[model samples]
Target: MATSDLHMQLIAYDYVNDRKTDGGSLAKMASLIRQAREEAAETGALCILLDNGDTFQGTPVSDFLAKHPGTHPHPMVDALNALRYDAVGLGNHDLDYGLDYLGRCLAQFQAPVLCANLKTSALPMIMPHTIFQREVQTASGETISLRLGVVSAMPQLTASWNRHQLAGNADVEPAMPSLVRAVQEVRNQGADVVVALAHMGIATIDEGEDAQNEIVAIAGIPGIDAVVGGHTHLRFPGPDHNGVQGVDSETGLIGRVPTVMPGNSGSDLGVIDLRLHRPENALHPQVVSCTVQLRSVDGETPEDTEIAAVSEMAHDKTRAYLARPVAQLSNPMHSYFALARPSHVPALLAAAKRKAISEAIAGTELERLPLLAAVATPATGGFDGPENFVSLPAGELKRRHVAGLLPYANQVWAVKATGARLSGWLERSALLFNVLRPGDGDQMLVDPQVPGFRYDAIYGLTYEIDPTRAPRFDAAGKAISNEVGRVSDIRWQGKLVDPDQEFLVAVTNHRAGGGGVFRPFDDAEIVVKKAAPLDQALIDYLKNPDCHDIRTAAPWRFTPKLGVSAILHTAPEALEHLGDIPSLHPEPYGTTPEGFARLRLHL
Candidate 1:
C-alpha cells in the first residue's frame, strides 16, 4: 500500500485576552495551543495556527493602548506572539485605533500579518499574501514537501475610518480581483493549497452584503483549496452557503469542506486537517480527506502559563492607567440593556444628539421642530444578552469609561421625513421583535422573545406595536396596514400630528442609511448638513449642562385592548427613569405598579 501522509491541525481565530480581565480567552488559548502542539507532535502531524482578526481592540486593554500609547505597548500583539500564531488577518476593529496604531500593533507581532485588500505602498512589510512551505516526514519516514498559500481580504466598509491612513496607498477597490490574482500567483509558485483568509462576514442578500462575500464569486478560480473566513463571527461547521464542511478532527470525519469561524473573542479554536496522498507526479498530490475540530477556550484545563503571565501584566497596566480619575460627572451615569426600560446612558446619548441637532438647526430654516433622537447601547445592542448593565461607583466618571460606553464613532445626521415615513421607520424598528399574538402570549410590555431591534428605539413621540397586526408597510415604504398599531398621543403644537404635515427628524447616519433595516428614512429629505466628526457633537453635548434632562417621557403611548397585557422590556438602569410609566415593565412579564393601576384606571 502507498504510504499515507497527514497534513493536519490548523488552528483558527484565537482572539486571546482582550481589554477585559487580562484576556479571559488568551490565557485559555495559550493552554489550548500547548495541548494542541503536544498532541500534534505525538501524532506526527504539522500544526499551523491562524488568527482571523479583531485582535487589537475590544476591551479596556485596547482602549488604554489607543489612548495612552506610551504607557503600555500593544499587549494584544505581545500575547499573540507568545501564542506563536503562524499568521494573522487584519479585521475592521483592528483599524479602529487608526492606521498608525495598527502598524505599531503589527510591528509588535512576530508572526507575518496578511491583509490582501488593505495595501500601503510605503509599508512593504504589510504583504497581501504569504506563502508557507513545509517539508514533513510521514509516519513511514518518507519526507513530503507541501506549500500553503494564504491571502486575506477585509470588508469595504472600513474605507470610512481607514481613509486617512489607507488613502492613495490602500486599495480596497480591486480587493476580490487582487485576492484571486494573489491565489493564482501563489499557485504559480507551486503552492499546493491556496487559502483565502477573509475578514468579511458570510454574505447575505441584505443591504450590508459585500460583493467579495460570495464564495462562488472567488471559487473556481485557479488553485484554491479552502477559504478561511471571519468578520461576521459566525460558527459554520459545514461549508455554509458554499458546500464547505469543517473537518471533524476528533471523529475523523474527513472530506468535509466546512468554512470555519471560531466564535469571536477566542471562544473556540477551529481546527482543519488535510490528508495528502502523492500521485505518480509528485507535484500534483491529491487531498484525500479534510477534517475539522473545535476546541473550547473555556475548557477546564489549566491556562497557558506564559500567556497567562503576559495577560496578567496587561491587566495590571490597564487597571492602573484607567484607575487615574479622568473626569467627574454631577449625575450618575448607568447602562441598561433591556430596550423597554429607560437607561441613563442611552437617554443621555439621545438627549445629547437631540440638543446638538436642535442647536445645529435651531434658527436655520428648521427651528422648533419636533425631532426624534436615538443612540444604541454598543455592547447590548446585538439583540442578545441579559439586561444591559453599567455599574457606576459613586465618584468621578472617567472620560475613558464614557468613551468605552459609546465606542463607535458614528456621526449624527438630520433628515426630514413625513409622519407616514417616520411611522414606517418605527415599524421597521418594531420588526426587530417577534410577532406575538394577543391573548395567547404573556404581557406585551416585557416580551423577551421580541427581538432587540424592535425595542431599541428611543422616541420623541410615543408609539405601541400591535404584535398580532402584520406590518402596515412592506420593506419598501408602502402602506400595508389599514388600522393596525397606532402612533397615538403624538402631540405636535399641543395636538395630534396631521398626516399631511411634514416633520423634520434627526437620526444618526447609521440609522439614516437604513442600518437597522429601517429603509424608509433612506429616502427622507435631508435638511441639516452632515456634521464632520459627528461624535464630536455628542462629546460637546455631553459637556453642556443644559442638555442633561432625561426625565421627559415619550409623548405617545400604546393602548392595547383592555386586559391584553402590554409588557415592556428595558435595561435595569432604564427602570430608574421609566419606573413611573404606567406601561413600563422590567422584562418578560414584570410590570410596574403604574402599569397595573393604568389598566384599572383607564378601564
Candidate 2:
C-alpha cells in the first residue's frame, strides 16, 4: 500500500476555510491502510506501507510547525511510525524547509528514509535505497523469505527548487543515471522483487527537453519490478491519464509494470497486489501477476483513532495559530472566478508583494526604477477541486485566510527584467485560455491542461489578452510561434512599455527558480533574495495600516469577441459574486459533473 504527496495533512482540518474538509487527511486513509493490511494477512500476503514523497511541507499547520522549532518528535514522523510505514521516499517539497531541518525531522523516522538521486552532505542519513527481508507463506503453506528491494528517486529539480537550503552542501543528479545505479546496486545485493518508488508523475504531463515526470522512463528500466509514482497530485489506472507509448492508462501498467499514483493529500490509498511464485529450482520469487487499486477517501470513510489521537495537540495548536487576528477586511475575499475575470484575491497578493519588495530594495539602484509584482491565485478550480478556493467573510482577517490566499512556503525574490521579458512572461501565461473563435458559442475559456498557479497577473503593468490568436509560448513555456501572441497593449504607467525598458519585478523564489513553466527569467538579474516566505510577508503587510488601503481591482481584461461565448468552470459560490465581475456578463449555465459550477460568458 502507498500514499504520496500527503502535504502535511495528518489531520482532516482545512485551515484555509477554517473547517473540516471531507476528502483528505492521513487519519481518514489510515482506515484503508488497516483494511488492506487485514486483507493481506487473511490471504497470507505481505503488506508493506510506503510513501512516495512530498509527505510534508504544505498547509498552514506545516508552516506553523516549521516556524516554531521544537525538540518534540515531529507529528508526521510519529504518525508514520505509529502507522508502521515500511519505507518512505523523498519528494521535492520534503527539502523545502532546509536540509538541516529535514535531516533533523528524518532522524526520528522509525522506517528507512530514501532519496536515491540527491547527494547532500547535510542529509547524510538519507539512504539511496533499502532492502526489506520478510517471510511470506505461499498458497501451498511453504514459508519463503523474500527480499523486497525498494529503490526511490525524485526529480532532479529538488536542489534547484531549494537552492537556498542546499546551495553549498548538496546537488541532485539526473534521475536516469542516479536511479539506474541505485537499482543495479540493490539488484547486486540479491533481491527477489524490485519496486521503484518514483516521486514523479507520468511523462505525458510535461513533454520536451525538460520533462519533469519520468514515471514512464523509470518503468522502462530492466531491474524494476513494480512502480509507485506521485508528485502530479493525480490518480492512476483511471481515466485521469491518457495512454502513452509504454503506459497503459486504462490498466495502470507502464511497460508491463503495474504502477499506481495515488491522488495527493491522502485523497486516495494506492494498493498493488503482487502474486509472486518461486519455482523449486529458482533462487528468487517471480511476480506472476499484479493488480493496482486506487481507493478513494471520502467524508464517510472512517479515520484511524490512533492516528488522530497522536497528532491531536499539534492540530489544536495549528487551529489557534491560524485563528489569531491579522487585520480587518473591508469585504469578503475569494478567487472563485479568478480566471473568468479580474478579481481582488490575486490583486491583494500582488499588492503585498510589491510592498515587501519595495522596502527590501530601498536604497539600492533597482528601487529607483519602476517596480512590479507578478502573482496568481493558487486556487482556481483545477486539480485541487472546485472547493479549493479562498473564501473569507467580511470581518477580521486571520492567518488562516492568508494561508488560503498563498498556500506555498516560498520566499519573495526581486528580479530585474526588460519589457521584452515581462511581455514574454505575460504572453506565456496567456496560454492558460483556449483560443476562442469569433463565430463559436459556449466554448471553453480556460485550458484545463495549464496550471492556474502559473497564470500570473503582473500588477505594475496593464495588458489585454487576445486568445483568438495562437499563443507564442506553449504550456511548457517553450516558444511555438514568433508572433507577439495573446498579450497586447501593455502599459507600465498609463503609457505603452518599450521592449528595452527595464523594471524591478517582485516574485516568489519558486518562480525565480523556475519551478513551473515560463522560464524567461534566466537572463533577469537578481536584485533581492529575502529569506522570508510569502505567508510571513503577507502577514506583515496586512498588519501595517499603510498597505491595508490597497488596490482591489485588477488591471487586465479579455479581448471581447462579438457573437462568441465561453463556458467557465468555477466554484458554486461564484454565483453570489456576479457583481464582482459585471464585465464578464456571465449567465449561469449549470454545474459540471466534477462539481464545478459552469458560467456562460458572452464575449
How high a TM-score does candidate 2 get? Answer: 0.96
Estimate TM-scores for all models. Answer: 0.75, 0.96
Deviation in angstroms for 19 in model 2?
1.7
| Steric overlap count per candidate | 39, 0
lDDT tens digits, residue span 309-353, model 1: 666665666666655554456666554433434455566667767
RMSD of 1: 7.5
Question: Which lDDT tens digits does candidate 2 get at residues 327-438?
Answer: 8876677788888777677777777788888888778777688988888777888887788777777879888888888777889888888899988888888889999887
lDDT values for all models: 0.55, 0.84
The TM-score leader among the candidates is 2
Q: 485, model 2: CA deviation in Å? A: 1.0
Candidate 1 TM-score, true structure as reference: 0.75
